[model samples]
Target: MRRVLFAARSAVALHRLLDVVPVFAGDARIARCFTLVPGSDFGVDALAVVDALGGRVVPWEEACAGAYDLVVSASPKGELALLSGPHVLLPHGAGFSKTIRAEGSADSASGLDPVYLRRAPIALHAMAHPDQVARLRAAGTGAASRARVVGDPTLDRLLASRPLRDRYRAALGTGSRRLLVLTSTWGPESLLHRRPDLPAELAAELPYDEYQLALVVHPNEHSRLGAYDLAERLAPAFDAGLVLAAPREEWAAVLVAADALVTDHGSTALYFAGSAADDRPVVGVGSGGPELIPGSPMDELLRSVPVLGRGQEIRRALDAYRPGAARHAAEAAFAFPGRALERLRAELYGLLGLTPAAATSPRLLPSPAPARRMPAAFDVHAGLIPDGVRVARHPVGLAPAGHHLAVEYGAAGEQVTLSAGVLYRRPLPSGAGWTSGGWTRHALDSYPGCRTAGVVQPCGDGVLRFRGRELPYAVRIEARVEADGRVSAVDPAVAVSAAHVWVAGHRDWDGGRVVFNCLVGEREFRVRLREATEGEAGAAV
Candidate 1:
């Protein structure tokens, strides 16, 4: 059996390897193994990815000693010269759009820099675009002779996952709301670094029901700073209702789910432009001003896309995404659109002198819901409209307190929120439901300010009980969002939230009936919250 060594130096590299590993399924002739290498300071974090992938890891020393037929690494970093094999170096990112300072050279296009390129006996340089090779050749990099256009497997997977956009959104807990993603690459020039407060600000600024906000931080950042530290830095955003993408498997999925993107000149903005969000709203800030390679794909992306200036109203700039915006530049950065796996598999088999089999098919990556912690408390704005109530929620700790407050049962009880108007829990077991009244009584008893308490039943509907002489009202939610004349479904929280507002101020008593406007998933129905008739006791009319 021919041995293959997958050298991983960073999370980015490991993700690239993951893109192609499925191509070798059921190949009994090849034994695949992985070795974590060093390039960035975050090389140690690659071990976590290795563990997560169940990548059969050989120690660096053991990997160096072994003779392999083909060695693949997304980066040519960390002692590639010592590994005995026809080394294939793939660009972990969208081509060579970054600027790197190597030993001796001041700054060069990252992957093409001759100082790093010619240092190893690299058998192949996997170019995403033909222009990468041109840049490499122009720089007089002797290794350019071995460069080949194998396309971008990362982009291929992203593009392929476009059909699953709705599924991606559903996994992330996004119902009918438009998903707004804030993406950043690592380093000082990243969007998060420059505008650390943006997540909280935007989360506060947007109505929770109308829009869903998510943060996609680079894995390298999570690596550079430990998980705890990263968590500390983003805790405010979390408290303010910003859904954070998990370290792996989520960033790309978020991109796939994004309806609008707010980003720096990082690769994500470029990826968003090329992928599902090709025509979606993309609001950019030029943190890469004079930093990125001028006229490069990354630069062209920032140039072509609209720039959101400092102190500019963020909402208005959302429409800044022009039609066919950055699509050309993104296309230029990637050569073959959806065939990276095919071209790459052929290239690897050729290097091993083995005929590549076409039986194995590449699978589109599944985007599981990111295990995110939703805010425990929300500052609500419940406005009485004509025969209905429009409720918007912003997680607490973001902006100043408004009129109404809602608290979940599991939250650490707040002294100031001891008098909260709305107290609720969702999907509670049938025994502990509002009708059963153990936890609800305790919750209302603990908070004297709360006049009503509620709990969502397993059926996605809820029951709200009043403190005084009122029967428990059954809560039902309907999603009324439509696209192409087709309505969408909403999360249970939407109906529960609006119901919280109704009881928060006893709006149902003053008004005849209220239509709870919210989403349930993707289907549309205008839900009515009405008082129970004498014939139908405790039933919401």
Candidate 2:
């Protein structure tokens, strides 16, 4: 016993009809059915029919209070606020409607919901009309979740029975060849109805009685016409073969049977276009709004009726109906139905405790593939630099094997200057605070022979001077070293190369013994030394 409440602000007849049909269908369990009518003329007769059929009828405000499993409604804002349970929003027809005013403004102000922008989680607009589904998907609210083309249940009723067609034709006393064109009377607030020249324009293109026209007035249109009864009074001008249907269901059935249709922008076009896919034709007249081309059966009908003078060219183009092209057109037009329904179901189920069936295997929604991570910076083969060597100045030169190294020189506490032709030897610098005896300097001096003689210096230009001879500064040493023990250098601003270089090392240079490789002659040699102070350093000397 699942309780479902069908709510609407108006349109009592449609809601009443929907409530009764499900009982005969048998698959759907209906614990309770309700309709909420706002104003006077609550259509007591319709309420009587509902009561006679074993359903309860109540005013709009009172009906909203009761608990229900699912509450479905046509008004998006009102119903969303009133219903305290799983809700289904059956948007009335496809084209832009009042809900646009409500949701459109909110969307404009707050920006789209991120869930809708990215995943579009199969909610929001699930059970909407077909075209509405397309519009929602186009707005980037993922189509995979929002709409399905299950065929509207309201129009489904018309498709379920064929006898209704004969009944409608018999009631009108029209021949089978007679084209039934139902025109809904536009209200004063309707943009099409208020224009004074539109009636005259409509009359010029449409000559009544030449083709059967059934003019239907929406219930609101009756009070809105004021002194001018556009359908009845102007019938003669447009060739008055006009037949009126007081009952709305009969009018819908007539639309189903009709060869073609003509109306301003309204839900009728959406309904006809959606449900009458197998029918003859349906044409809609719009004042230059979004026009549905003649592809689907309903689009054929909509394309047939010219909108007075405005869409005459479009009508001419649609004159020859192509049955062969309808297959592709039908697919393109009807693809949204299943997606819409799935979206609706997901949204509704999300409101309840029911979890959606997990996607067919985990592969359908696979976890994000793992990202590759880079290896750490300092690996085993990498050497660490000694703390004190400051490479201050150097000349550019090619080494013995065409490699290049910046010859660096330094004393205990002074900045190290590197040049191209210099070799640093012992007896580092005579500093009073650190070294003990003059013999200590002599021992340091003797360590490297005459290799310490020619210290290289730059002469302001791009040249190095060694023993008073200028050598071209053909190589450039980059400021940083690579992790692979290579230093980058450019020669003559053209060729770029990386070469092996080493930092200086010394003992007692910071209380720790330091050693570094230096290119000595053709082979590499490791130099080690210690710094001593006058007090404790003198004893070691």
Candidate 3:
């Protein structure tokens, strides 16, 4: 059996190598040894990535000392030359569009940078397009002689997964909501770094039930910040219902699920644009376009893709979107296209000194739903409607700017602070539930600034619980005409906010029915509450 070493330097590099490893699956002739090469900041979660995939790992030092037929790596960084074998370098991104700068070195074309290539001498250099090979030759990088156009396996996998877009969206649980994805390469030029608060800002501007926002940050940032710190840093965005795709495995599926994209010069954006047929609009944020190689695919993309434009809200841009020249431009950077896996397999087999095995179709397995967090608290904004009011809500933790605050009672770390007024869930007094006004007075005494509180009963599950300060007894309420609807089973937090708004307008509001018009994006949900008797309260606690 021919020994092949899978040398991974970073999370991004490991992801790229993973695409190649699948090509050799079921080939008994090749024995694989995986090792994570240190000496780079892009190390966090790198080992976990391998463990998650169930790879057979060899210690880094032992693997370096051992003889191998082939040493396959996705990145040119790290001290790879110490390993004894014929080294092959794989491009981890969209054909190395970014100009890279090694530590204590000048800027140069990414893959063609002789300094890094010299440090990690490679026998084979896989290029995604002819333009890339030509660019390498122009850079005076002597290794250009070894570089060959083998197409992009990443893009190829994405093309193979295109038909599963509906499944991808369904997996993300994006119900009646347009999925919006924001991508960024690591560094100051990234979308997140440039506009640090963009995620929370977008989460606030876009209506909660209408838009689902996801982030696809590069693994370099993922490694440097560490997953825990990064997640904590983006805690606000998470609280505002941000879906975070893990650095490696989930981003492709997230891209497939997206209805729109907001990006910087990340390579994934270019890949997505190529596959999505310009059907989904992309709004480019920041001026990181020039950071890529001149006339490279990503550079051209930024030049043509719609700019977010200073002072223009992304929500407004998405509401009025137009297709850009992304597909035509991005397609030019890929050669062999759908046949990358086939062509790349032949190339690797030749390096490993083995006859190419019969080609078997490879497919990307359906990705799991990405990790997401729903807002536990919201600043509920309301305006007047016919009998009730029109309302909208924003996350209190991320971007608080509403008339009243609504917080999920008994939520983790539940801390009730004095705001204009707060809404929560509570158990109504046993015999005096919304009738004797005992629960309202009891709730007011317990939670400061709590103007509205609600409870759902087992029998009358989809009903409202409300009361007035001056009224002798509280009035039980049933959702008006919404017997079997989303709002009928309304969230206590949201429902209490509606009650809070209703009371402000109707302080002298005696018992009666009041309708609420809630705006979810451009659509309106009418939630009306008709008075119910104490008997119909159904022992709601």
Candidate 4:
């Protein structure tokens, strides 16, 4: 019997694949399955099916125990390390389908081969188009020799499943009629999240009450201020008829049930296209490129599909490109149930010299041994800053008890010294230089005391006097380094403002030899100081 190992990180993708893979493989059973189960209410339909088919389920770290004839992985991140045997890479078809490869760079395609192509005596299969296969071959080693174009297995589920249009409508509280499911795919870096003018764009269009709107939220979004959250928050203002679906996965029925679709540049759009076909009026909102899969002939099929830059345009296109009697096109477009498992089995059988009957029967694939934990007692090293740098003290004032004083040095030789003290009344110049006239001193004996004095004698670098003590000081200096090699002070700050402040100090990254500016404020003041390095200023004299 062929020992097959299937590993996936996402329960959603696994369940979706399991929905149809069993039908194609005949009695083929899962030998071992490894998955991550984050404690979320999201159901694992795929794991359920695997158990029903007699597959052993285990934790993800258990995959390395025994040799396997075949391995299937859905995680792109873990695939490279898991390529000991013939492997099928099923990257969960999400944002990856629409990822634009950088120009003249095959990083994405080549990155896939570390687990598939270079592992000798193994085969690679892609659930993408022939063009994708060609691209992978062009970009990856041994890919030209091994890669094959098998359609996505997840698409097969939609194709094989009966259309629950009425059932979905009833669940959504909408009557049996045409519905538009707007799947939200918001990105953190996109302008859609930061711009203020987006509400008008969505509001000007999609005002139809007859078209029931279901807003599907992305899973990664954390808060309402975020792009996905903002879309959800703004969705109600644009259309009171809109329904927001949170904790995603609830929209799986919606994807298969909706008559029309709207999406951003995400994999859900590809799933809809790959599964639904070009039958329904699918609109690509806020997309700059072609409406179909890049580097694929599917673009020809999606030529008539509208790619809208604005919400008004999307609405107009939706109204104009209504599905013309192609309501049932989704089923036909994504029809390849059990194809993924069959392909997986064929590849495994070819590599391991096993028949379908033998491979499909129950067999024990050894469990991966538990990881060896390191001993708690290990050699540890700790060091302290050298003595030489003088830590400056903050001036006392009627501030909070925990409030501390800090000195911030900026680039361009500027400095901001902040401390709580009684506002001294002195007519000071208030210019660049500090003078006795600028400040009106109001002295009240406070718990924490403050003192300042200067005694100058050197024109260049030499011994200078401060409060009767002789110390190394400089006038009109660019930077100040103490005897311990730590920063003593910096002159002339750059980009200093009431809201933002910059300070210069001796940084560790530059061999502890160069000065770098860092931000200083209420947030950064709490950081504790350690020992000083050589050449840093010693105690303030």
Candidate 5:
């Protein structure tokens, strides 16, 4: 039997370690003890959590000096770093869309230290899935070699709570009123911080009779921002009938009870998207841009949902919300599904190099699962179609195909060109669910154009380009078809060096609009495209 130290530093780490401790309860091969970091703000709360779980908490020095065989921690930093024996790294959560899964860097807010893992002797690095391991390896994180797909215990809790949705809703007294819970993680760029008045604005606008609003902020908000500050900030929204949920409440309960979710870039969104508790609409506020890791289930959800770059879009999205492919994509990300606890227990015992005692329990350890294929390459789904471009009548490609546009750069300048034809995808069949659409090619001239708006500078008849010294250039084009049947002139698409980009348009009969919003780069540059009222075609060339 090995003596294990569960090191707690942050609130998130404590919550995660607690999930594992119970599964190994009364086991003979491992003896577990909890220890808190000296100055963690959540130490008192963590102690309460441990006491409730009937776990032992030893003093930090005593635990460290006890010569423990293994140290298991949510983070590799702090005491885990100081421990002499091999340690198992248990990161706080899954859903890597917001965090960088690469080797050297860690999610700044996640309390993990990949550098610590790189520095320490890691006996095992247990992740939610093999794809996660692959990403860490590609990022050059040294611990990838010791990584295993053990699944997440919290996910199991959420999955098991699925059938109790009604009970949780009743507890909230939410009767027939559609419940929408808004969650904002801690960060300056977090939605609540960015739009402090958002709840009041949403409450005042959304009909009180039909929908009830609730706010669940990250636990750090309570500690970092004092009660007076929180009360003062949230008072107006509370007065407007917004139910403020306690930060310590089980997130699974909230997810089970709520009909819809609104959040920014955080793990809460990932948890909701990845669970089967509900397939209701989840609207993400702010930043209608790419995720840190593109094409995961959560990433797919963000792309599919109407990510409101502006607050006004929130109401519009909710009015027309529906659960689509993102829900299924998210649900599929869980490798062990409802069996996380059992699977994780197996991984823990494997890490300790021991077999479980048969007399202890029949389900003590789960049989090893077959390796799952790594999730890769996000599908080209609906809702990402650009504004104001119509699919050509005789578009050549499959319903949902992808094409790469070429962008060539040189000391002279940069040139951008779209593929020669309109690569289009047809509407998915009714029962097809959320399968990836196949894209096919046709002539670029086949699609019709619409009236163009927004800032622009004219180039030739229908072309625009940007050339900035050492900066990646970006251009947005909106065009309206003129009476002469010519595609309204703003930008002609062509390919150049260094990078490849593409433009694909589909006919959206429902909205009577054309869409084109696909450009790959960190920064966007809008050309000063307005031509002088009367001049020799002078522009910001």
Candidate 6:
């Protein structure tokens, strides 16, 4: 028997590998260890999953020292330096949603790292779609020659078990009610993190008497907000009659029961697009602006399906959603449905120089339905600006990590107003002074409380006014934004010299944008600013 180790760095990683591990466990010719990478953070979901997998845990150092015959990882990060065996890279999720990585950087999961592509000796890369292989090759990942399409084993299992939808619906006590599933992936750019009122807004717009709403949040969000804490934060929506599914429940079953889906751009949307049996309407909620991968599955879905803006009403979006185009796109994206697990098993076994065991009995994998109406669990990474206004100084186009001026704000029952402008930084002639670096472009969001690409609102003489709206009491300007330039936070002078923003009329800096944080009765408001010298003003590139 050959020894194989499945190493993971986070709970999200474990979810990705869940489809493959069980098949390996059923085999007699393979010895497997499902363990964590030493020194990596483990979310509550990951811990719960690890416990359920018979606690086959080992430290990264210990596993590498064990002389495992082969090692399988989501990415080549962590203590991979300790491993001496042949390696395989099975991505934890699908899509090229993240920003492009530097040639040799191991900072992201897209697997475009130069070392992994060029010299780290990756033996095989099992991809979810053939398009991914082309994408990898385009990105110059070293393993193009070794890439193979194995479909997605998770989707395979879920699609094959479509009958479970009835059970899931029953378990949720949603008899005869059309279930609307809302999924938001974790990150500052995620829908709920920026627009905390999305659930309430959506639920309110969707007739409660006609349809039932269920929310499926990302595990990273649960880790950022403790499971219980996240659940508490979303309690208002739950109380308003939204069904919060349990984290441990198979997302497949939840999707199975959904009559329609409203989601952001993430793995959840990718999988849902492929596995929805009824070919139901998939309503995409755009980040306040256009930030989707053009021609990718997400873009395809948006083009074919009905898409709503960040703060748009649900009923209106749904009325325009068409299901035919989505079905066609799904067929193209996931070609070998229902055979993914079998294909994955064959490929991995071949890589290990062993014959896979004979096929098991013909029956759906055992996926139990979760209990009815669980509390919502929210998650987001820390250091994210939460429901507030933030200001950070950097070169005209650079954002320094961990250096932000953020303030949380809320109103009870009144509307808040916001507007903002930028001051560019540039070097002056003859060493006399540094002034404006380039044209001042003011940023605008289509909606008030979500992270979307900043729409460049043309301005005159370094002044621009964003359209304002009166929102419900709990709104905030929580978008992922920054100035464009490189400058260190440690150097106060350099930071001060960088381009920045102010709330138009106020002397105080209010970020690239400004917000009026108040309820109908409150007199108080907040703004974020970074000090700058007089010479830095009117700096045009």
Q: Compare the candidates by lDDT and give the number of the best one.
A: 1
Candidate 3 residues lying further than 4 Å off, grouped into runs, are 102-107, 118-123, 142-145, 163-173, 309-312, 319-321, 353-358, 362-371, 386-389, 397-400, 412-451, 455-461, 469-517, 526-528, 531-536, 539-541
Global lDDT scores for all candidate models? 0.72, 0.37, 0.70, 0.39, 0.52, 0.54
Q: Write the per-residue lDDT of candidate 1 for residues 344-366, one digit (tens) a residue.
A: 88888889898875555456757
**Pairs of colliding residues, candidate 3:** none
Error of 1 at 402 (Å): 2.3
The true-structure Cα RMSD of candidate 2 reads 34.8
TM-score of each: 0.88, 0.45, 0.82, 0.49, 0.60, 0.64
Better of 1 and 4 by TM-score: 1
Judged by whole-model lDDT over C-alpha atoms, candidate 6 comes out at 0.54
Model 4 lDDT tens row, 441-519: 1111221221211111112111111111223221122233446664322211111111011111222222222222222
How accurate locally is residue 185 in candidate 3, as Cα lDDT from 0 to 100?
A: 88
Superposed model 2: Cα runs more than 4 Å off: 12-29, 37-55, 95-125, 128-149, 162-164, 185-210, 218-239, 273-284, 288-307, 310-541
Off by over 4 Å in 5: 28-30, 38-44, 51-54, 99-114, 226-229, 288-298, 309-313, 328-333, 357-541
Better lDDT candidate (2, 3): 3
* Displacement of the residue 277 alpha carbon in candidate 4, Å: 7.6
lDDT of 3: 0.70
Worst 10 residues of 3 by lDDT: 471-480
The sequence of per-residue lDDT tens digits that candidate 3 reaches over residues 211-301 is 7888888999888887677778877777788887877768888887788888888788877886673368877787674456667787777
lDDT winner, 3 or 4: 3
Q: What's every prediction's RMSD, in angstroms?
A: 3.6, 34.8, 5.1, 24.2, 22.5, 21.3
Regions of model 4 farther than 4 Å from truth: 1-3, 10-29, 36-57, 82-84, 94-97, 100-122, 186-209, 217-250, 288-304, 309-314, 322-541
Ranking by lDDT: 1, 3, 6, 5, 4, 2
What does the lDDT come to for candidate 1? 0.72
Cα lDDT, model 5, residue 434: 18
lDDT of 5 by residue, 1-541 (tens): 6888888876667877866776676777778888886655545566666788698988888876777777788866664556666777776756655543333354422323456556667888878876777766765657788888867777676666666676666565554457888888765657788778888666555533335677777766755775457758877566545666655435556766678888776667766766654467888776523334455555666666766544446667875656664576565355766666676667767767777543221122221122211101111221222322211110112123333212111111111123221121212234222111101101122222211111112332222111111112233243434466643322222111101122222222222122233222211112122222322222222
